[model samples]
Target: MDTELLKTFLEVSRTRHFGRAAEALYLTQSAVSFRIRQLENQLGVNLFTRHRNNIRLTTAGERLLPYAENLMSIWLTAKKEVSHTSQHNELTIGASSSLWECMLSEWLVALYQQHKDLQFEARISQRKSLVKQLHERQLDLLITTESPKMDEFSSQLLGHFDLALFSAAQKTTKSELKYLRLEWGPDFQQHETGLISNDGVPVLTTSSAQIAYKLLQQLNGCSFLPVEWAKKREGIYLVPDSTTLSRPLYAIWLQNSDKQSTIKELFKTPLIAQ
Candidate 1:
């Protein structure tokens, strides 16, 4: 089957409008329509039900979506693998934005320095998206705080990092300080729950530590941040009587991955000074 047809179908399905899909794909509206028709004809099913101003996928289209996505991911992976010459081996590593900011950036630098022959692709995404891509073989390795429960994947503890509550206010009581929450992971959430019983609702909650850090700098508030990050910045002092949190990080990849040996070797490179 032509992959272009699948690609076109995905775009139309996403946008729910042929004209918008055409604009996104840089094709004429009629061309996009033709591709969809070709795909439907080839499959011998009406993939979409068109209405006046609404478009939605049919049951068959819904069934085909996952397969199309898997196929595209596989095709991209194959292209990357086949294009690699003797001089370089390609790797795609994925992690959450918070992980990238807190640790993976430094690890990646060490990785590249140690393995000069390797070409790298870094994908910073949310946990759900990263896990989905890992399952689809779109990523070679994923660094995360949560372990994948699936049997097809293997996980290893990368290291632990310390985070502490920091406040911009020179002197403020717990009730007086504004709270900004940065989500570390489930483990951190549980740890936080045990420490603070009546901290009140946070002024802001986010997944990115950088966002929380910037907000703390701009506004007189308190939030949990990496020990190193807090120490480096001025005017943000550790909150008195706040418990320091240690969070474990993990590296996960497919058990039967083709890059298993290389991934294992890369783990030998120290991510953080223990």
Candidate 2:
């Protein structure tokens, strides 16, 4: 089997779209189509159920995915075992939106300085997407705001990432606190007004918290931001009655990676560090 074909297969499986996978792989859409055709011809199985706008994995593809992924992981591990120079010198880390926003740069720097001759790639992704990338042997580590649920993953909870509500520099007096409700995912929609007492005036709504923060800086409204981010700013006043929301950070790694496990032990970072 061609190892390069496996890369294409995994990419197509990930994106479920030839065009997008091709863009990521830096190949043309037609080239991606050709690679898939070559893979299907070699394996004597159709991997995708084609549709106009979407592609789903077939039963064979579903069964083959784990086997193919494990095969790749084993190859990577074996390569790591015998080699003297570290290949993880070029490492990629994945993070979700809020993690990227409030995540400590020191965490990345600490991880980076551990290895010699290392290059880093910072990927912005959703939690599920990050998990998939990690499983595919594509990412070195994943930094997330959510705790891990699966048996295969080990999650370490770092200290709280504090967030607070902030209003414009000019708008004072808590008697009238107009708000901009900033919500990103389905999980955080409940805490709109938060502990801060708002005057029932919803200025705007957005799906991205960063956008809300920017808008709050420009307009006459308030939004919640990571306390670190808020503290760095001089103009904005922290809403008087606002409560701090604490979101814990998690460092996640693959269960089967012998290399990462050894590194984790050496770092002396516990699974539940305060």
How many backbone clashes does every candidate have?
Answer: 0, 0
Give the per-residue lDDT of model 1 (tens digit) for 146-166. 887999999999888888888
TM-score of 1: 0.86
Candidate 2: list runs displaced more than 4 Å.
1-86, 110-117, 170-186, 193-210, 262-274
Identify the candidate with maximal TM-score: 1
Candidate 1 regions exceeding 4 Å error are 58-67, 70-88, 197-199
Per-model C-alpha lDDT, please?
A: 0.83, 0.69
lDDT, candidate 2, at 176: 57
C-alpha-based local distance difference test score of model 1: 0.83
Query: Model 2 clash pairs?
Result: none
| lDDT score, candidate 1, position 174 | 50
Cα distance off (Å), candidate 2, residue 216: 0.9
